[model samples]
Structures are given as C-alpha cells and as structure tokens.
Target: MVVRSLAAPPTPWSKNLVEPKIESSAFVHPFSNIIGDVTIGANVMVAPGTSIRADEGAPFYIGEGTNIQDGVVINGLEQGRVIGDDGKQYSVWIGKNTSITHMALIHGPAYVGDNCFIGFRSTVFNARIGHGCIVMMHALIQDVEVPAGKFVPSGAVITNQQQADRLPDVEADDREFARYIVGVNDALRAGYLCASDEACITSIRNELTSTSSSDSSNGSSRNISTSSMMTSPYLSQDTIAQVRNLLQQGYKIGTEHVDERKFRTGSWKSCTPITAKRESEVIAELEACMANHAGEYVRMFGIDPKGKRRVMEKIIQRPDGQQIAQPAATKENSFSGSYRSYQPSVATTSATSGQINQDTVAQVRHLIQQGFKIGTEHVDERRFRTGSWQSCTPISASSESQAISELEACMANHAGEYVRMFGIDPKGKRRVMETIIQRPGGNQIAAPSNSHRSSAFSQPQPAPTYNNKSSASSTRLQPEVVEQIRQLIAQGNRVSAEHVDQRRFRTGSWTSCGPVDSTSASAAIAAIESFLSEYEGEYVRLIGIDSNKRRILETIIQRP
Candidate 1:
C-alpha cells in the first residue's frame, strides 16, 4: 500500500485546480497520487506510492502501455516546454512500453523514451533518456543525454555534457533489457486482470491440468493452451504475448524437479532444479554461476544476480588475471575453543623471544582475545601487524625471536586452534613456523638467557590462583586436560551439556563419564581417533566431558 510522505506547506502555494487526464483503461492504483495537468495514456499501470504532479510547469505526458512502478515520483520543473512531433507541449514525457521501477525520481523537463528502464532509486533531473536505455539502481542523470540502448552502471552520476560524452556507446541494439522489463509488466498486468475473474482462474487451472495430462500421455513437450491464455478486458493480445514469451524464457514459471526413476539412477533426480526463492539460495546460485557459468546463470536467476557474480569474479582473480584459490576453512566461527589453555605457551614464547622484561605474552593474549591471526604463517606474513600500534603491534624483538615464539605456540596448540583465536594462520602455524624458527639468527630464540628463562616453567607448579583461593580447594589442571581445551578452542567451539548425544564420543552420559578432570586427557583425545576408526570413513561427532562439567562435541569428525 502506498503512503504519502509530504503534507502541504503552511504558506499557501497556488491552489488552481487542473484535473489529471487518466485513460479509463489505465490503472492508477489507489495508493498512487496524480495531481494537476498530468496525462496518462491507455493501459498504463501507475503502481503504489507513485506521485505524478504537473503543478508548476508544462503538462506531463505518460505514453500508452508504460509502467510507472511503485514509489516513483515524477515532478515537473519550471522550464521552457519542448514541442513534440504531434505539436503538443511537454515538460515531462515518458514514452510507450517504458518501465519506471521502484523509488525512481524523474524531474522534468525530462524526456524518457519508449522501452526504457529507470531502475530502483535512480534519479533523472532535467535529463533525456533515449529508447531502450538502462538507468541502473541508484544512478543519477542530471541535465545529461543518454543515447538510445545505453547501459548506465549502478551508482554512476552523469552531470554534464563532457561526462555524457565519455560514456561508452550502447553495447547492442537488441533491446533485450527493454523487452524483459516490458514482458514483466505485461505479466503483472495480466495477473492483476485475472485475479478477480473467478471464471478465468477456473479456466486457466483446467487448461494447466489438461496440458499436463496430455504431455504425460503423448510423451510430448509441455505447452500452454491458447484458448485458456490470460486475455481479459484488461489484458490485450500484445500483453498476453509478452507474458507468454516471459514464461518461455523461464521467469518464475511454476515447475518441479521430477524424478523419473526409469531415466536416472542417482538419489537426486536428473531434472530442472527448483527455482531458488530464499536469499541464501540466491546468493549460492550467484556464487556457483560466478565460479562456473556466469552468463547463463544470471539469465536464469534474474534479481541483480550478475552484479554479485561480477564482484566475486573480480575478488577471486589476481591482478595478473590468474584465479585465486579460496581458503578451504579460514572464516571465523568455522571453529571455536577456550582461550585459557594457550596462555602459558604464549607467555613462555614471549619470554624466549626477549620480551621477558615486558608483558608481551599478555599483549599477545589480548590480541587473540581482540581477534588477531597470531596462530598461523600469517604472523610472519604480518596480517595483524598493520594499523596503530595497539594489541597487534609488533613486539620489539628480532625476527628470529618472533619466529621461534610463534612456532612454539603453534605446536603447543591444537589444529584449527589458531583460527579460533586469530581467524588466520599468521605464522604458517604448522609447516612454516617450524622451518622459520630453525633458521639462523643472532641467537636461538629457544635458548633464553638463564635469568629471563627462570620463570618460564616451575617444577610442581601450584594450582592456578583465582581471587586468592587456597590450593586445597583449587585443583591443578592436568596437562592433558589443558591440551584438550586447547584443541577445542582452536576449532573455534565451546563445550556445553546441551550438545551431548548418543552418536560418537560413545561416553554414555556426563554422569556416567564421572568428573571432567578424572579421565585421562590422552584417552579422551584418543576417543576421537578411535571413534573415527570404528566408523571407518563415516562422519560422526566425538563427545566428551570438559572440566567445566559440560559436554564437548567434536562435530562430524572424519579421519583419513
């Protein structure tokens, strides 16, 4: 439904009444508002929230079979009138079969020619739009002349003659875009005309049934019955033809993915896939198209699908024109883990890296908490080392020290643990970190001076203190338990009682497994490998109990 956004000014403007001349056949929807000296031709559809006012200047003329779609605002500016071939004076002239889509603002003296599309939220002020031209969404044309069949990219702003001159020539004179718009409008008009016609709806349904039955019996291709075509008082033969052509082009025509058991053996049937309606599926289809068949895919799924394809195509390509391989499992939230486990390793590494005099370990831990990629090879590549010298700020140490510290952290942590903390492998956590730390430098980072290395590890260290708690009440976390937590944390996940199930980890229940710290960490960790071994190529979740008294779910773990 259309809603008016403006009210009349308190200061009086001219109240002279000039009734709008709208054709009886045209549909000026209840939500659209038409004011003084406006002339709408036959079969035009003035959709919801459209405001066409010719109050201050020459009359506005909308030609036949045009569509003024939702939220279009057409205003007449005070300018010298242009005389048409028919000797009529005009300020704003929209030609036949044109489509002015949602939220576009056209201010006259502007001339929009036949079969043109004024895309979503685009603006045309004192401009000339030639036939079959496309003014894409959010584009602006101010006092400029767009030649016929031209394509204007989204967000393009053409203001002057020089700017207009620089515009590339229209790609093709085929007018495919124009035809598609007209076809869509024609379908809308036909549907609107048929919605209230009970007899017509019944006839169409019968026709569809008969057509399907006949196709099944005769083994013939599907076709619509001519007699049951959408042709009411509101829809002419041209409109029907346009709708039929659109259907033939496969725009939202209802069909199914029929599984013909006799023809194919696969679980999924070899048939036309159902149309994707959800936003996610649309995005997926667009992505698939970009990676494979762009042109054909865009043509099939048309709602600005090609724009995303183009963007992704560019993103996945190197400057040298080679395609970049997408990272298999790099995105944050791909896994999760606890942060407390990696604290000591990070501290020890910092101590070895000559940052023992400062709280570099705390800084690194803070970076991980703040989402930095300190775990992987990206560390050497310097992913987090940019921007202001904050948490990701470079440690004041030699490259050798940094490499050794990063390597120690990677080995001490579980796979995917770095990603959970930092979202990337900053130091090539597995392979590169191992290689770089061993390389020659001033002094080996592994061997910190005796004075600084003294506190790196303590023999029979006391249980971690919290709020001045006593050692009797606080139990020291086992190395295995800490390692388990590290593994879970690296995977970017957390253990909770809610995720426990009968599937994989095979521990009957949290109560049956006894306390979290009671079990050997090796056995619990081994259960993951054992589960995968027992399942043998099948996917399963490895469940276990964490020290926090919650269940841990290692999802869909498939071992090679």
Candidate 2:
C-alpha cells in the first residue's frame, strides 16, 4: 500500500500536488505507507506499521469508521491547519468511529472527534479530540481541546486548557473498551479481506448469512474511479469523496435535485449553479449535475462562498433501492441549512449592538444568562497588526440564542479581523471575561488602555511601521513573512495584492499593490504598508491574487 503521488514543489508548505483519495471500502495495509494529501474514508482500517503521511502538512482526513491501528504515525506541520468536520482546512481530521490504537501519534494541527479512542502509545499533538473521546495508554494529547465525552487516563498529560477541561467523562466502561477496539478492527478488516481474496470468503459468507445485502459484501477488488465510474454515474464512493473534499476545501460546488416525491415533500431542485472552478471543472459540473437529475434525489453541497452558507450535505443520487442517508458531520451545529441560507441581514447588526461591543452585548448576555461559558479569539490585519490572538473554536453555544448565534458566527467567520470574547468559568474551567469584541473598524476600533491596548497581548507595539522615503532603511517583514502575508489575505475572497522589487523580485515582474479595496484585513495590511512605503529598500515580494487571478501567495516579504 505505498499510495504515493505528491511530488512536492510549490512551497508555502507544499500547496496541492494531490492524489490519494482512497475510499472504495478502505483497508490499506500491505505494510501500509500511504502518502501525500490523503483522504481514506469508508470503512477504513489501515493497520500494518501505518504511516499515512501527507508530505509536509496537508490534506489528511480519515473519517468513516476509522481504525488505523498498527505502528501508527500520521504526520503534519507546515503552517498548521485544523478546522474540519468539513468546514474545510485540515492537516489531519480523523473523525467518524475513530480508534487509532497501537503505536499512535496522530500529529499535525490535528482534530479527532466522532467516537474517538486513541489508546496504545498515544500522542495527539497540536490537538483537539472532542466527540466521544477515550484516549488512555501513554497519552499526551498536546496543546489541548479534548472536550466532548473526554476520558484520557493511562499516563495522561493533556497539555493546557486546564488539562483539557479536567478530562474524565467517557465512562460506560470507557465506551465498552472503545467498543472492543472497534470490534477487533472490524474483525481485522474482515480477516484482511478473507486473506487476500477467496472471493472474500464468499463475500464474508454472503455478509453473514445474508441479511438481504446492502453493499459492503466486498468480494474485494473495486476502486471505482474510471473518471468516477465514467462521469459520476450516481456518485457515491462517499459522494465522490465528498466532492473531492469540497473542491479541495475552498468550497462552492452545489447541485440539488428532488423527486423521491419531492424528496419526502420539500422541494430541493436547484441544480444549475456550480459554474465550475476546476476540480476537473467541478467534477464536470458534478457529473452534469448528476446527469441532469437522473430520476431525482441528487444532493451534493458545500457552497460557503464567504459564509453565505450551505455546508455538509451529501445525498448524491437516490430512489432505486433507496437507503443512502449519512449526513451527520457537526462542528457547532452545521450552518443552519445553507445555500444562501438567506445571509444578507447584518445591516451592522443590532438589538442594541449585535456583533459585540455594548460591553460585548453585556458580556455575551451575562455569560449565557450566568451558566457561564463561551469562548472565541481571532486576529488578522496581520495577526491584529502583529498582536497574534488565534483560538476561535470552543464556543459550544449554551443558548442566549445559542450564545449570540455562536457569537454572530464568530463575527461572521472573522470578517476582516479582530474578534474576542471569552467569559468561560463553566464550573471553574477558568477565564471569566476578556472582551474586545470585533475591532478593525467596527465601532471603528480604538479602545486602548490596558496600558494602551492595541487589543493588548503586549509587546506588539513595534512592527507596523512602513513610512520610508528611501535612504534604504525599510526592512519590516519577516515576522514569518508577515505571517505568510496575513494568512494569504485571510484565505481568499478575491484577494489580489502585489509588490515586487529587486529587479522585480528576480524578473517575475508583479507590481500593483492595489486591489484589496477594503476586503479589510486592515485594508489588506494597509496594502502591505503602502508597498513597503513605496519600495524603500529593493528586494520586496508579496503577491496573493485569487478569485481566479491564480497566484495564491508568493512570499519574499522585504529583503534588500
């Protein structure tokens, strides 16, 4: 199982070279070593000395019935990533029926939700565990999250967030010994596929004496893709790996379809809008929108175009022996039915201050009416103009309209930078208030005075200079290339900024540091501080582009 296929060479931490989709009832182990941009899903069980690598940090997700047991070691770390329960962004996700047992070390800016159980030599770095967690033997779960159903006991260490909110909950005999190690690795993935096929022992004895078969009788061999079974003939291979993981997670690939009596009486229809953005023209317009609704039910979703919403939906064809239905994926209650879930209503929010600041809406309505809990943190404008922040994910919403609509969807998913609010204390798991709700020009920012708060987190008062009139001294960048140009202009929305120099950064030309026109991450870091104050000292660089103007990042932030 030497999967392989990312001959890396795009640096900004290896940007997509792809090829490792997996699913067709996953089972890897031929002394497993699956490489780069991995995906896996569907009854997964890669055991033998496993090493699911995604080159430097990457796509890596595992999901459906996960069980990666033997010598486990999933890697990661290039500019860290993590937000996935399919709200895209991942350098490791691993949810759905999880159980990474043996020599485990699921690294990366990881996350492990749904039915977790990492036991043997465990070590989940830059963590987040959450859903039905168990953890245990030699555990270490670093840089914490570990919330939902937590347990972690044997040699435990769970670094920070107060040892993952005092972990210790998953009982019921620790979920029946993690369901007996995922039922002995689902019977060692069906006896390693009937010891490499004898027609999978008559398809595992006709799926244990026939219960009227519903797929998974796998007499082995079936890898599906021949251009997704000749242009998606009714998708399914987990909806073509969730439409190539939501078009490599930058979203927008819709399709809908109805008829199973208007999908049980409701009216989905929609299908004519993908307008392709290459994932082979959006799976050839999602196989011509499931071959023009081949007798209805279709489904497919993922449209997040800057949260006008519609994430996680999946049907991908139905009504012919109908029994598809999976769609559970929840990370803070999946965006309430999106596909333009009618988002236009933020006329600068109100009911007396909406996106925070009316003393953070009375400190998030007195911490969810005093049961106290709510967390969040964000920063941009190049990390709050160099103050840094981060954290956002831990607002398990406990009503006050689900914690102010999850704090207005975390200030509309960090709309142009700086969002705060913490409050916590749910039975002393600390942090009792720390406001700064939404800055960078919402109430036009200015709040200073925790000894002059530039949204105080201390020592960030230096770098934001850029005023040069050339006598050569204009050096600023390299606070990690201005945080990789402020997270590539906060992950696209028609970005396009530029700046060159040093013989046009070695003749690739680039120049107009213009077009960010208030897509406001501090007006695109003040257009790279007015292009390093008009190219003060040669060798500059920058350039982000997107909205199909392609070039997504180029670096060289100021050299000379």
Candidate 3:
C-alpha cells in the first residue's frame, strides 16, 4: 500500500510532517492508498482500491475491526470538522466494527458510529450515522445527525431536521443482517491474505486467458451496477402513470419545489420541465425531476399551454412536517374532474367539522403543532376599512376542538361584523397569519359594486371560482385564506398583482400586472377577477401594501 507521510499546511496550529499510524494487526491491501495523518486500529481490513487520504482534513481515525471494502473513498473537506464520540474533534471518524461497503463515501465533517452498515454507493457528508444504523444503497445523509439505531431506506435524501427526526427505528432483522455482513467480511479478510501464496498465484494464471475470453463473450453475466443502467427508486409506476394521464388529457406537465423555509412564504422554483416528445423520453424526464427534488416540497402541475394556466396540481412532496403519504396509482379516468381548483382536500369538512371552519382546519392544527398561540380580532365594516381591530378573549387552547369552539362563539357574538383569526409566535411575539374569517352582514353581498374601480380595470367581471365553493349552501371567504386580493383591497390595503407562466415561474421572473387602488370592495374584486381571467392558466399573486410602506403581505391569488 502507498502508506506515506505529508507535510501539514502552513497554518497557525499545524506545523509538522504527519504520518499514518496503522496498527500492526490491520491488513491494508497493496493496491489500497493511505496518506498523511490517518490512524487505523487493530484488526481492521482495507480492501484493494480503497483510498484513505487525510492530506487536507488531517487525522482521520478508523477504529478496531472495521472493514473498508474495495472502491470505498474516505475524504474530507479542509474546513469542516465533526465532534467525535470520545469528545474530541475529527475530520472523519469511523468507529469500531463498522462496514463501509463498495463504492461508499465517508466525506469529512462526518461520523459513522460503531456497528453501522453503510450500503453500496451511499454517501454520508456533513452528517452523522448513529450506532447500529443501516443506511441502504444509494441513500444520501447530509446536514443532520441521525439518531441512534434508526434505519434509512434506499434512495432517501435526508438533508433537514424534520426528516432526520422522523426516520423509522432499526429492527432486529436489520441488525442481524449487518452483523452477518461483518462476519462474512472477516472470513474474506483471512481468505484473501492466504490466497497470496505463490502456488495460489500460479494456479490463477492457468485460466486467466480463458476467463478473459469468456468475459468478452458474455459481458451481460458480469455483476455490475452503473448509474446509466439503474432506474431511480423514486420514479415508481404511479409517477409514470400520472405523467401519462396528464399528457393524454392535452395538458403539459411541469414541476416546482422549494425548501422548507421558502415554501412557507409561497415561493417556488421550477425544476427542468418535462420537455421530451416521445413517451419514454417524457417518463425519463419526469423521473429525473422526482429524483432531483426527493427531499424538498415538490409540486406537480398540469399546464394549459394555450391559455397559460394550470389545469390540475398536487403536492408530490410535503417537506413542511406533514405525514408523507405513499403515492397511490391513478386509476383509468379517475384523474379527471377531480380537484379542478386548488383547495385543501383534508382541511375540508371531516371528523372535526361542527366546532370550526373545517375548510381551514389544517392551518389550525399546524399552528398548534408548531407551538404558535392562537388569537382573534374583530371590527365593524368601517373599522375594518380604517385598520382598527379589537382583540377577542385570549384563546390558550391546546386542542383543535377547543380553539375552534372559541372562534365560532366569537364570530357568533359579533355577527354582521368582520372578524379575523390569527396565530402568534410566543417567542418572537409576531403574528404568523392574520386572515379575515368573517365579512360584514354574514352574507355574500349581491355582485360587487363597480363604482370607484380603476379606469384601466373598469370592465365588469364574472363571479370568481372562490364564491362558488362551500360545504353546505352558504359560501364564505376560505377560513385560512381570505378572499385573497379582494379581501385585502376591502381592508383599505393597496394591492398589486403579478403574473407568470409555467416557464417564468422557474426563475421567479414575475411580470407586474399593475396595482389596484384603495377603492370600493367590489371594484377591487372586479379588478382582481379581470387579472385572473386575463392571466388564465398562469400563476398570479397579490401583494398587500398597508399604504404606510412599512407593512406588506403576499398571498397567491391564483395558481395553475
């Protein structure tokens, strides 16, 4: 093996030529390469083609009885360092009895605890794998520390805390399987050393020519796993069938996703659009997008190219702490006439119906789960237009039913007035959301009045889709979502709208459609309706500016 020392960089703390301190009992194959400041403990086996280089991020440690299989790479960045199990800092630490299988990578600022099994071609970077964990093939573990004894399924992209917290625990069968691999490798370690005898080498040369000829004649029989030949596990039968369904319905497919933080503020960036013409090519493109955004919040939409609007949409990945449901196959003709408009299916009427607005129940549950305090505000129509809000009785509810009961009672007392629901951060003391749940008269006013409308947007508009959906007979502003632009305008806020097609959504290159003046509520609603119909099949959002220029709120009014 190319075991050698190298001079440390010219730094304040490092000033010496460092060498690898390998234990005498460890077997490092001749073809394996070991470099500066690396320590290998007793009984460890480094197979052929394994590379352990600590030249940059120095002082790597491999504990006793660990096996580094062929084609493994252990390298680290020059800057990052991880806290080791013994309370010392290390660039990379592999604890005792761990098995890093073929083609796996253990990048620095990383740690693998004792008795772990890192599967083939998997990667662990800027992260920790707890003791006895089994990370399956092609998985990615980064940025978060996995708890002890958890199991990571194949192709998992774990990059955030929420995902790391929710991983399943390792089972008894999994532990036994990992132990079996270690036992088998221990046998192979002994056998490989004895196979270096002169007689053994002579016998191998006899059939070498024949073996080469046979390999050439029957290459398919060889055990090989290449990236190009493998299908991504994330690209399942259901995803492909969904793609086919969208395409057959004369709708083009597109995808967009965002990390947890950005997804909260209604910001989404698109992935590579499925631009292929052939059926197989489209499926491949779809697969590529799914594989690329495996960990983030991904949204798939069916676009109407001619009109520039989204005809259908669904969230494929829920990164916001929602329980991930497995993708169910879309049945024949089952994908049509369902979910035409974007609405929360779960938030609608369900088991938790009578006490609160079931259509916005998901938000209430989420706010509570995130430890936000719920509150409410009320005002008459005149006060609402003047931005004056009076606080209702403080609701320190721990349960959804309790919170909703208080909210419904508050609205009942202030009937015919405007009441809004809000959630506040106890720590920061800021409102997370302030949505108007009730409007004046507790009724939908006969078609919005057109007086005081912006001259450029003076044309009358048809009834909006929001006014048509309701649980029973009555329709109201969505509980969590206000009447969007119309409600914000009615509240005396200056509303501005922006529109973008499927292509421009990727870059967030929005085109301004102009602002709605502080006019009559009907006029503002009409202006928003005009923008919606004009930009049909596109994404449209309203920015509520509170006139003083200090406060602003953004709400997506329309999306395809």
Number of the top-ranking candidate, with lDDT as the measure: 3
Per-candidate Cα lDDT values, in order, are 0.45, 0.60, 0.63
Give the C-alpha miss distance for residue 494 in model 1, angstroms.
61
TM-score for model 2? 0.29
List, residue by residue over 328-416, the lDDT tens digit for candidate 3: 21110011232112222223211122324322344565567678888988888655534678998888777654566567667777888
Task: Name the top TM-score candidate.
Answer: 3
For each candidate in turn, the TM-score is 0.38, 0.29, 0.39
Model 2 has an lDDT value of 0.60
lDDT of each residue in 1-560, candidate 1, tens digit only? 22232232321223674677888888776667777787888888887678887777658899999999889999876765654435687988899888898899998888898888787899998888887777666778887787877766555667766556545444332254456566566667667667657988889999999998887785522223233343232223432332234333333312112122211111211124436553333334323433342221111211123222211100122123232222221111111121001112223223323312222333333334434344333122122112111122222222323433443443333222211112233453321111011111121112111111111211222223223111112233322223333344434434221122332222111112222231333334444334434545332333434345343332222212
Instruction: Compute the lDDT of residue 76 as modeled in candidate 2.
Output: 88
RMSD (Å) of each candidate, 1 decimal: 23.3, 19.7, 18.4
How far residue 326's Cα lies from its native spot in candidate 3, in Å, is 21
C-alpha lDDT (0 to 100) for residue 255 of candidate 2: 69
- As for candidate 2, its clashing pairs are 310-338, 449-453
Ranking by lDDT: 3, 2, 1
Stretches of candidate 2 off by over 4 Å are: 1-69, 72-100, 104-116, 119-133, 136-138, 141-149, 152-165, 168-181, 184-186, 196-240, 244-431, 441-560
